[model samples]
Target: MPREVRELAEDPTGVDAGTQDAVLLFVGGPLDGRVEIREARHGEPLPTVTHVHLHGGPKVVHRYDLTPLGPGVGVYHLRPQQVVRDRSVAD
Candidate 1:
């Protein structure tokens, strides 16, 4: 599975402009592992993410830095324009 190939299959660009951008920004970085893409927002810190690097799509070329906001109780929100089924399995 590669970014280029996946991108063709699931074109984030085809999705709503705002949603596509949010998805890319939300999950664009060196992730510990690949997680599924969930549309609905969650209260948990780690919800499934869909972005350029994590998802097998045409986003491998982009570079992003993950900065910890801080160790505090704050509202972290994720607003998605659309939701897609995830195709990941645990080993």
Candidate 2:
């Protein structure tokens, strides 16, 4: 997890400059306490799923879904979504 997210999660008001856009805070799974800055547009909905790909060893992907926390802020929790594996690679 990124340190900035931990800081922001602790104090949302302490968001740094140039990140005035809507904030997406991740909770649970590998992305727990991670933060993502998204451009907020009127009538446009935020992403429902967040994808994290691991390429260090066996290729894998984790998915998380958004759970609204409040206006301009949301917590994306790790869902029961199946982990995607790169079948192209040999075990």
Candidate 3:
């Protein structure tokens, strides 16, 4: 199930196009003891994300950042442009 998300605020281009770019988060699934959250906006996909360092490297990456938010809730993040696009799981 997707929860704990209402809107996303990220701007890397530093351009005010007079449009509010918001994103929804879909956090679920237990993949190697880490929660996965995908980005969605207006029920559409954003960008594609690939977990590069699957091994024991850094905790966060460029496209995605898997970090624990709470005891059972984990916070997943995407960069400004590219992330996990068109990816979702059924509840």
Candidate 4:
């Protein structure tokens, strides 16, 4: 995954230099099922995308949508979000 992200970093897609929303995913789990994304309202939990489940464990890709709060922002749905960087392209 890190190698893939490294290639994405050099993407010529004109990614800006700021924050971006990226989806993280775990390799295996109940989370492997379909997931949804909801909007975060006032005083509410931020929007999140459930990626996968760790077999009999908790949701692995349980995290909020990293909506870019600034420029250079990009989004990539990565099976391993922790490894994939913002504005990175797929290898």
TM-score of each: 0.17, 0.53, 0.22, 0.22
| Candidate 2 C-alpha lDDT tens digits along 1-91 | 6565443354467754334466788877788888976775443335566565767686556667777666567778787766567899999
Q: RMSD (Cα, Å) of candidate 4?
A: 19.1
lDDT of 2 at 50: 54
- TM-score of model 4 vs. true structure: 0.22
**After superposition, which runs of candidate 1 have C-alpha atoms over 4 Å from their true positions?**
1-52, 60-71, 82-91
lDDT of 1 by residue, 1-91 (tens): 6666434534434654223212212342344333333242432244333335446664443333333343211122333334444669654
Least accurate stretch of 10 residues (summed lDDT) in model 1?
17-26
Tell me the lDDT of model 1 at 84.
Answer: 43
Q: What is the descending lDDT order?
A: 2, 3, 4, 1
Per-residue lDDT of model 3, residues 20-64, tens digit only: 233334333222344333322332233444444455774444454
Q: Give per-residue CA lDDT, model 4, range 15-48, as digits (tens).
A: 5332323322222334433333322222222344
| Candidate 2: C-alpha lDDT | 0.67
Candidate number that wins on lDDT, 1 or 3: 3
lDDT (C-alpha, whole model) for all candidates: 0.35, 0.67, 0.41, 0.38
